[model samples]
Target: MKKAELLRDALIAGNTWCRANPEAITVWVEKVGIETQATGEASFMYSYTIQALATDFPGDVDDLMLPLLGWVWEQQPDLLLNPDSNRKIEFEADIISDDTADFLFRVPVWERVIVTKTGGVVTAEHLSESAMRINSSEWETVFDPASEGNKA
Candidate 1:
């Protein structure tokens, strides 16, 4: 599947799952702007930052994130085989310098499932790890303050 198609499938699947299980799953999308420096006299550059959130699952956060990741992996197998390729199922974009864009889609499970103080049945550590992997792989620069200053 094409990169955009893969991302679309993941988003649809996540939304479907959330809709089907509203009591256990709460999914939402968040769009953020990313600024990058241009080589020339460009005033600004922007990219889409999409995150998925799944909450109140019966199992750990990894349990939810793994399935979402699996959907992404199944749709975009090239991402697993190619290190340099931008074939992620969660976020896909063709950004240009000095432009603004917004991506609307279902949020990932990592962002939602919070561990309660009672430690009911979910654990935050697992979710944190899975989120870390996704962040490091696809959303690496989302939290980087230095990258924001790169804009003109």
Candidate 2:
């Protein structure tokens, strides 16, 4: 499928998932495009944003989204990590929880596709490292600043 089409589909799926689960207060998708300078190859990346409403629910936002995220990863393992291709792609999902507000914010579910051309043969490799890094950085940014003042 074309990169645009894949992104559109991912967005639609994410929105539907959020709506079906009302605990989700906010949801959106982000697209990241990466291109290689020497190879002139390019790929599109997809991620999801979700925020859960405050309620007495049993599970946290991460708990709910992790499985969904895993499903996406499992369903599209190639898009997650293509080993045979020089092309590289990456994706990540970010989930956040706020005990003070009793709410959760989940953003940036990830997808990436990489394409490379060598000897007229095209290859691709999907990398999850970027996505994981993005999610971790985002999470840290959210909580790290707040935790700074509490240092003993």
Candidate 3:
């Protein structure tokens, strides 16, 4: 798996899991920590610690994380995220909770990230400078035939 694709899938899984995890619904990533682990019998493993605030995580972090990680593994067996891949990605993550919905924000969030792969070590590079801005539009409630004018 490539860097971009790996990040994309991880984001998607996060959003999906959040939606079902109540207090979730919005995956506001606050802190993204990366670490590598090594074992004598095998290669090093990469792990990510993605933290979130109460505002972004309505569900229990402990309860949701295991399943979320499981989903990621099931969906992507060749996950580019493993430490062995010699690859890592970073981004500002929009870092907001009041706006985007679940998976819908992946594009806007990831476009601002940097993916690094070192030569037998670690190298980093930015994906894009593309920024996402919300337009200032007044909220207009359309007529609901199912409800009376005042009820709407």
Candidate 4:
């Protein structure tokens, strides 16, 4: 699957409230840009929007942010690592009503594709951010190192 799809899935799946009440929320992922080099490695930037569709949602719109942020933290640590980078993740929210709102998140993330040739054929394999980690240990939020392995 593409990184955008994985991100959308993770955002929805990570939230217990979203999973339990699927009809109450909606997620849309749009590719913002792409860059390719001579090495065949391409970077895809995506903007995903999560909309609270139900008029009777039980919780505040802000409550839905943690799970999505957690997914980004674990899958794409670089966005959280550098605050001054232009590629940092960003987000905004528009409240449609007291119970419904639209949350748009701009995530500048890239998936590394390692291409190789074997005599007669060439193949490419995509690598996840966690797979390309510099540190072998698990990824932890910079704000709180003690919260390792906790997605939320």
| Candidate achieving the largest TM-score | 4
- The alpha-carbon lDDT assigned to residue 34 of candidate 4 equals 40
- Compared with the true structure, what per-residue lDDT tens digits does model 4 show for residues 14-104? 5666677766555444554444566544332333332223233456655555655566666666665555653555666667777666666
- lDDT (10s digit) by residue, model 3, range 1-152: 13334433443454554445534333334333343334332222223333332234433443334443333333332332335531332223333455432221221112122345567666444343222212331111111222233121
**Highest lDDT: which candidate?**
4
Q: Model 4 scores what on Cα lDDT?
A: 0.55
The TM-score values for the models, in the order shown, are 0.29, 0.28, 0.24, 0.62
Tens-digit lDDT track of model 1 for 12-70: 45455444654533233345343434544323322233344333333333434544555
- Candidate 2 structure, TM-score to reference: 0.28
The lowest-lDDT stretch of 10 consecutive residues in candidate 2 is 85-94
lDDT of 2: 0.40
Comparing 2 with 3 on lDDT, the higher-scoring candidate is: 2
- Residue pairs clashing, model 1: 44-98, 52-107, 52-108, 53-107, 53-108
Sort every candidate by TM-score, greatest first: 4, 1, 2, 3
| Whole-model lDDT, model 3 | 0.33
Off by over 4 Å in 1: 1-20, 23-47, 84-152
Model 2 alpha-carbon miss at residue 29, Å = 4.0
